[model samples]
Target: MTESVMPTYGRLDVAFTRGEGVWLYDEQGEAYLDALSGIAVCNLGHCHPAVSRAIAEQAQILMHTSNVYQVPLQSLLATKLTELSGMSQAFFCNSGAEANETAIKIARKYGHSKGIDKPVIIVMDGSFHGRTMATLTATGNPKVHAGFEPLVPGFVRVPYNDIDALRMAVSHWPEAVAVMLEPVQGEGGVKVPAAEYLDEVRTLCTQRKLLMMLDEVQTGIGRTGEWFAFQHAENSLPDVLMLAKGLGNGMPIGACLISGAAVDLLEPGNHGSTFGGNPLACRAALAVINTIETNSLLAHVTLMNQQIVAAFEHALSGAEGVQFRSKGFMFGIELPIACTELVKQALAKKVLINVTADKVVRLLPPLIMSADEANKMVNIVSELVLAFLATQPKASVA
Candidate 1:
C-alpha cells in the first residue's frame, strides 16, 4: 500500500497466507489450486515437512556466517551438485540473476585467460536470463530493457533453434566465448526448442571452442521431471550450468557449475559473495535434494506430467481453438485469441495460472501434484479457454 516499496511487479490482489501441497489459502480462507507454484520455485510443494524441519533445526543452530570461513554444509552441497550434474565444481550464490552473473564472469575470465579481450556471449531470442544489469542485457526480450540505458555489451543474439544463424554469428564474431541459453525458455512462454537443437548447439560449441552454458533457473531440480532438462536430450550436457529457483525450495540459493576448461577460471580472491553459500541456505538446499531423492519426486513428476499432458490433449486439443506446447510439468496453451484476461477469470474460478507473450497460458505446477490435482488444473483452464474463445468475433478467427 506504500509507493515507496518499489512498484516493479504488477501485484495480484489476493494474498496467500498459507500453502500445502498443491493448494494455497488466501486471507479469507478461499482455496486456490496453485498451478504456478511461485513461478516454479516450490517444486517439492509448499511447506514440505522435510524442508521445514531442516530450516527449523538449522535456524536454532546457525543462520548466517560470512563466507570467510570453512562451511561444511556448503562443501557438502557443492559435492552433491557436482555428483548429480557431472560438473567439476560449483560457486554458490543467492539468486538466478547472481548465478547468471557468475556464469558471465566465468565465461569472460575463461576468454581473458586465453589472451582474448572483449569477449562476447551468444544468447538466444525469447530467452529470459534475469533482471540484473548484465543479465537483463543478456535477456532477449527488449521490454525488460526499456528503462535501462547503456546496456552491457558483449552479447550476440540469435533466433531460438536456428543453428545456421549461430554459425554465421560465430564466423562473424571470433571473440565469442560462450553460448548461454535455457533448456526450456520459462519466462518466454515455456518455449521448448527442437529436440536436436541442443545437440547441434553442443557440437557447434565444441567445434568453435566455446562454453555451452545453460540457465536452468526454472527447469532444474525436477521441474522438468529430470534433475535438469538437458538430461532429457541426447549429448546436450552444458559446460556451465546456472541453477537457482528450486535448489533451496523457496529458500533463495543459487549455483554456477563449471566443467572441462571453464572450471578453474575463478581462482582464489577472484570472486566471492558475502551471503552466498551460507550454512543455513546450504542446509536448506541439502534438505530439498534429500527430500526429492527420499520420496522419489522425480518419478512422481514424470507421471504427473504425463497425466497433465494427456488431460490437456483430451480436453483441449482439436477443441476448435486450442494448441499446446509442453515438456514435463511446464506447459503453455495458446488459445485462438489473446487470453490475457483469462488469468483473472481463472482466479475467479479459484484456479491460478499466468499469461505470457500475451496469448499463451502458462502452467508450472508443483512436481508433487497428483493425478486429481493435475486434472483439476487442466479442466479449469480448458473450460476458461473454451469459454473465452466463444466470445471472440468470428472475423478474428485465424
Candidate 2:
C-alpha cells in the first residue's frame, strides 16, 4: 500500500464528499449533521454561497498578485476587520500560525525598542496557537514541543486564570515584555477563565508595562456571539490580536491586528508575505464578514447556543459528570470517561462531534444553525451519550 500524505493526523475512517450548511454528505450521499465545522473554520457553514461565490468570481477575475502591488480587496477586508475589532492596523497571512508568528515578531521588536534584550512573553498552560516553530513553542502543551528540541525561547509558561502566579513569574524575568492568552481557550477543552480574568490581565500588563496579546484565532469571527470575542468585552483591548480559522469562513486567511503602542513596531521591510493578502482570499473574507452582518448571525448563534445548552442539560440531567460549558456555538461537555469513541458513535447516528482534552466533547457547530437544526443535534447527541453511558461499568470511569 502507498500513503502519499504524511501521517500527521489521527484521521477518522469516514470521508465527507460535500457539505452544505450544518450537514455533510458522503460519497454515497448519506447525510451527517456537522457539529465540528471543520474545527471552527466554517462559521458560515460548508460551501457557503457568499464565500463560494466570491471565491469563484475572484478566481476568474484575479487570484494572485505580488504583495508589491496594491490589492483593493485586501485593503477593504483590513478596514472591515480594524473597524469591527477597534484595531488600528492589520498584517494578513494565510493561516493562524503565520498570524501568531507575526504577533511574536512584533512583540520581539517592541521589546528591543524598549531596550529589553531577551523579550520574554508569558503564555498560559493548555494553550494551542499553531504548529509552526514559534507558535508551537508559544503553545503551552508540552506534547507540541516533543521531537522539536531546542524549542523557540523567550516564551514563559504560567497557570491559566492565575493572575498572582503570572505576576510572580513576570517579576522573576526582567525580559518580560508581553502577556498572550486566549479570550476562551478553544483547544483547551473550550475552557473559559474567570469572568474578570482578562480585565485583571490588562491591569497587570498596564502596571508592568507589558504588551497584552490575545490569541482569538478560534474564538474570533463571531464564534463568541460578537464581531470579535473581545469586542465590548470588559474594555480590555489587546495591543496584538491574532485571528484565523473562521475569518475566511473556509479559505486560508489569517490576520495579525495591532493597536495602541504596538502599532508602529513593524515597518516596510520588517515583515512581508508572498501569498498573503491576495485578492481571492480577501474577497472571500470580505464576503464572510458581509454575510455574517447581513444575516444577523451573531444573534442567531446566541439564541441557538442557549437552546442547545438548555436542551443538553435537560436531556442529560443527573447523568454523572455529564455537565456542559458553552459560549455561543463553542461548547464542551465533560464526560465521566474518555469518550474518544464518541466520534465514530456519533457518525453512526448521523451526527458529527469531537473529543478534546481526553474527556471533553467539543462542539463548534455552524453559527447560522437554525432552531430546528439545533434541536435535532441535541436529540441525536443525547441519545448517543445515554447509550454509551449504559455500556460503561457501574463506577465512574475516572
Q: Mark the regions of model 1 whose C-alpha exceeds 4 Å error after superposition.
A: none
On lDDT, the leading prediction is: 1
TM-score of each: 0.98, 0.97
Per-candidate Cα lDDT values, in order, are: 0.90, 0.89
Instruction: Please give the distance, in angstroms, between residue 144's alpha carbon in candidate 1 and its true position after superposition.
Output: 0.6
Distance from true location, Cα of 161 in model 1, Å: 0.9
Candidate closest to the true structure, highest TM-score? 1
1-398 in candidate 1: lDDT tens per residue?
Answer: 47897998887789999999888999999999999989899988899999999999999999888878889999999999999888889999999999999999999998998888999999989999999999999999999889997899999999988999999999999899999999999888889999999999999999999999999999999888889999998898899999998999889899999898787789889998898999899999999999989989889888877788888888886567567889888999877677789999999999989998788999999888888888889898998887788788876756
* Model 2 CA deviation exceeding 4 Å by range: none
